[model samples]
Target: MKRRNFIYLTGVGAAAAMLPAIPVFGKEISPEQALEHIDPAAKKIMSDVALNAARSKGATYTDVRIGRYLNQYVVTREDKVENIVNTESYGIGIRVISNGSWGFAATDKLDKDSIAKAAELAVTIAKENARLLREPVKLAPQKGYGEVSWKAPIEKNTFEVPVKEKVDLLLAVNDAALKGGADYINSILFAVNEQKYFASTDGSYIDQDIHRIWPTFFITKIDKESGKFETRNALSAPTGKGYEYLNARPEDKIQTASGTLYKGRYDMLEDAKQAARQVGEKMKAKSVEPGKYDLVLDPSHLWLTIHESCGHPTELDRVLGYEANYAGTSFLTLDKWESKKFNYGSKEVNITADKTEVGSLGAVGYDDEGVKCGKWDIIKDGILVNYQAIRDQAHILGLNASQGCCYADNWSSVQFQRMANISLQPGKVKLSIADQIKNVEKGIYIVGDGSFSIDQQRYNFQFGGQLYYEIKAGKIVGMLKDVAYQANTQEFWNSCVAICDQSDYRLGGSFFDGKGQPGQVSAVSHGSATTRFNKVNVINTARKI
Candidate 1:
């Protein structure tokens, strides 16, 4: 998390350099050594040593996090593998509240002597910072569970699976695209396992093992005569699962008019074939006539919308301007939340912030600060109900406990408020994706996430998609090209006319949701059903460009 020089993704492309564009950094480790678990008893002794040092140094409160972070990425283009990276970062981070100020320090050294040194340094920094403090930090009381543990519900550890298996799968995906007529293809598989141990002076010792996976690709087709090209991205979603997620199962597949949908499990090869065909069709799709029309949005597309428009804005830190350094402040200002009557959407709109939903990227038994995870409504009956908060911010909301949303992307990074799995609750009425599509008139049906733009305040926005179909008089007429929708956050959600029933609910996620000034990336998810929004303005992105 503290890399001074690191490469960021320039953009998505099916045809680019022969090698992969991004790099993974952490302590280096071989693939075979990746999934080894840390010893909890050893971690507890380290925690005690650090705690004694901090208390001896006049620190009143302290918490220690010992973590081993592991990540593997496999990249391939066409027939050959481009890059296979395996990274591991191991360290201890200590945070302390002394002299009415908060300070943090981390070190890769795991010995008692080194950890004690880090602990003392944290207290020293806190005392120095106390000189400029105007008010003492106010942390809500927490009840330690004594000693506890949690692990991601995964049947097969992707890290334990042979590297050859991952490589073979990605290569097969690329070959399927080529056989389906894609001019070029690039595929990637990313996996992560976080082994963490948390202990605090408040009397808690918590150990957790977490896992996450993402398999994605970009496929392109070019019309040589016109020298114009189009691209389609794989519809596979990142999930909090294991290698089993890569396995294809008929029971877990949802086949709809939008093509094949997946839940719990995914079929990368099948999806690649669909991506090849779709990108080809995209090249010949009709150009849209820009105007206001209803929009039928698949969960894949709507999830990003929810993440930007609702999830970011409702974060208590963002609304309070604590996150203004990078992601900017919120449009749903604190005053609006206090009113508790601000209409954020229609009566059909019910958004939630959940840290306990199984198979969700943000799902955890307890957050980093040792608060138990739970769920709460963010928007209910179309009204702003709550903002995501941690122990320090809970007082502002007159809450007795933290909302349990605090997190740190790595051991060396200090934990802070991060977005949980923010989702739009499914409609109570019995409605299906097909049923929702049948009601749209003169609209565009969109699938898969694409380019998006939003104001610093998370208000006005524009979004695109991987595939678009013209919907006329309750029927999908034909594929459309060069389409994007423009709307304000509140206006768009208020325009929600319908949301499909729970049966249609599905998840969409991001592996790199970046926030804060120094910047840390967290994986989170957004769940939704096929939803209909009325009379949203459509634009021709190609014409504008």
Candidate 2:
């Protein structure tokens, strides 16, 4: 069993307590020091040392990854600055295949001697562990792009942004919440930059600079006399961009009956103000009656469902039972995929996994395994068509190349198959959010992610949302609280009755998604338009909890 904090962070809400401590491999750095970048030519020289050493040490294949990961966090509660963190991790990890087995070693020491020693050790370990191999590792063929570089299309690097600017923004957000009658409020701004260089015997030299940022907050309102409280979380999605993501524009805001939803850019201050007002409404909202009702799920609310039920179950490793740590094996067995007749969802459900999507957390030019990244379909016309796979497992599906879903949280962690940007494709038909909702006579509209529970097999599940509104007679009637819906994986997807077109599509993502035996966290985005699911199960969570 994986004995660690498996709960990943979406926003600073209930799961905040379970946030895992980020393992630091290097010394803490100042804000200015975080902006320092290593020259790719210098990294190439060091990488050549390891690759040559491994080849001389009798390794058939080898790869070297030199990484410098930087992070900055600004946190505040109410009007006080709680904490600020700036850290950097720099290291080199070598992976080698020898005697038909794989082995790995990592070190923070970047000198030529250290790199060579690590490479030799990796080969020695691989030879020694060859006895335990069930069969030779069957790696699919991948053409190397000689000396290529990729960088996230960020307008401004977050590390370059002034620390005081971030602090002020978060403080203002908290102030807005407090002034709006919130009993308590906490806000945070987190940013990351990954400077990575990869070299392999496949004759590929890749340099990549990746950036990601998330701005979030939590607000609570307490009715002191009744000893009851309500909470609201930020509706911002983490994106693979720089500080520019927080620069919201007028067109970026989507006006909804429930409130304002952000698209590409986010208005953090406005969101905090709306959250404060909404929390007050939540405190006065009526409890939802337990019964079947059509569910109108916004992208913010549906992303978590897609991540847990659709994304996790389709990982090639999970389907084959090789991955069973944080979450168990999939209900989507290999037989079902091979048959090509498994109805994973309704015809309205067409899911695609894209690693090259702009502004997505998983966007990358090339995967860790030196394979070019692109998009592929996971569910087409309601059938299980494909899965997220890496270089080693591509042959299982008769694939020529990997889907580029491989990632490692840190230099010390081994690269593995991780989810890409798994998204529910927008409907081809031009359907607006209003049109989709008007057709639902008796329904509940859910916005923003909330508490979620899924079984080990990724089948049975229950999900709650941050905001719930009752819909009657083709119109929103009032707010409802204590709302949760339960469903099986197959049953829920088949109930997908309608989906909005591209105009309403948006993204919601997790900045920290945990997986693997040693447990490495990867950030991924899930995109979708507003969708409606027909009559299903609704429960009163107030009575249960």
The lDDT per prediction is 0.89, 0.89
lDDT per residue (tens digit) for residues 1-545 in model 2: 11132222233544244233543335668998887768899999999999999999999999888889887878787788877878888888899999889989988888999989999999999998898998988888888789999999999988888888998999999999999988788788888898888899999999999999989888888888977888898999999988999999999988988989999999999999999999999999999999999999999999999999999999999998887766699999999999999999999999999999999999999888888899999999999999999989999999988888889887877798999999999988999878877998999999999989999889999999999999998899999999999999999999998999998999899987888877778999999999999998999999544
Model 1 regions more than 4 Å off? 1-14, 17-23
Of the candidates shown, which would achieve the greatest TM-score relative to the real structure?
A: 1
TM-score of 2: 0.96
How well does candidate 1 score on lDDT at residue 522? 88
lDDT of 2: 0.89
Give the 10-residue window scoring lowest on summed lDDT in candidate 2. 1-10
The reply for model 2, stretches above 4 Å from the true place, is 1-25
RMSD each, Å = 1.9, 2.7
